[model samples]
Target: MGQDISQIDSNEIQKMLQKFGKLDEDNSGALSAKEFMQIPELTSNPLVERVIDIFDSDGNGEVDFTEFIRGMNSFASKGDTQYKLRFAFNIYDIGKNKL
Candidate 1:
């Protein structure tokens, strides 16, 4: 469990971007909880607040695609324990956060 799922790869980045762009209803590069809940698949996470918690570093109510990437990069930085890395990311979205 010593992994950080935030270490998204190139493919994952593309997917994330596509999903983020679609979720940004205002055509802005950011999204809010209201905008996020619109995603059918994301309902499973139920921890959208946590995602917002991490991505919204500025304590803002929303996150821009740039902010998302920045958060992902920081959480998934090299030298992080595998479990921590995976824990921070969706590597194993079993709906549980354990390390």
Candidate 2:
């Protein structure tokens, strides 16, 4: 079976944070739309903007480390297929925010 994402340890989290740092080009401790687009994984994702919009909880127009990790954790949590789907929907739902 694939490794459980929620089981990721500190080292892995650190690595992810480091990657996030690299993606945050302006050193603003947050990822703006342009910076987010620079990530190869998200390059072709049509919903990248929506995903960032959803995760940018502070309505700051950027995703900070906390919001980033929270969004990641939502995906990482152990769950059945239905639960995972719900999580995805919940995260992807950008309420009251114009995109």
Candidate 3:
């Protein structure tokens, strides 16, 4: 049976993944869109599209590793804050600007 996830810190898991970049040591600044699809946290988030937009530095329909890393970092640092605030809007709209 699968472990119960109610105790999980979803945000932390998502942030951890966001901290790591796609594996590509060739100095190539691109990651296939397929690679992005493999991320579990991304399955439910529109951030996938956002990252793709940011990573496609050349607008060539692809993302290099460096660009991918940067995109993830931005999302972790900025996007996560926004997402949590969005979720907590009814409770504390102030969370939006704290980050």
Candidate 4:
């Protein structure tokens, strides 16, 4: 993720902020796994725990706005195919074992 946070458009930032707000039901300024799972897409995802683990760098069992923004920015970046492929693999191979 060579792209700087400044590179993200203002509109996109606002959009992501809105999403964060929606997910943070308790308004604690962070997303607990229960709150995160509120999203219908994530509700059924088997790897949701790993996804949170990858982004919740502080291990506080919650994802703050900054962490949320950074993770979303990387996911949203329009970068090289190889970079995207590697990211996909990282998500797929969260167990660090051969598939």
Error of 1 at 25 (Å): 0.9
* CA lDDT of every candidate: 0.64, 0.69, 0.48, 0.73
The CA lDDT at 31 in model 3 is: 55
C-alpha RMSD between model 2 and the true structure: 5.9
| Candidate 2 local lDDT, 1-99, one digit each (tens) | 122446556775786699789989889999998887886867898888877776687888988876666555555544345545654675556584322
Question: Model 3, residue 41: what's the lDDT?
Answer: 67
TM-score of 4: 0.74
* Tens digit per residue, CA lDDT, model 1, 1-99: 222445567776787788788889898778887887676755777676666666665767888776666554554445355534554674335354543
After superposition of all CA atoms, the RMSD between model 1 and the true structure is 7.0
Best by TM-score: 4
Give the clash count for each candidate. Answer: 14, 0, 6, 0
Q: Pick the candidate with the highest lDDT.
A: 4
Model 3, span 3-66: residue lDDT tens = 2223335675565444434433333444566765666767776556654554465667776544
Lowest summed-lDDT stretch of 10 residues in model 4? Answer: 79-88
User: Could you give me the TM-score of model 2 versus the true structure?
Assistant: 0.69
Instruction: Locate the minimum summed-lDDT window of 10 residues in model 1.
Output: 90-99
Off by over 4 Å in 1: 1-8, 44-46, 70-99
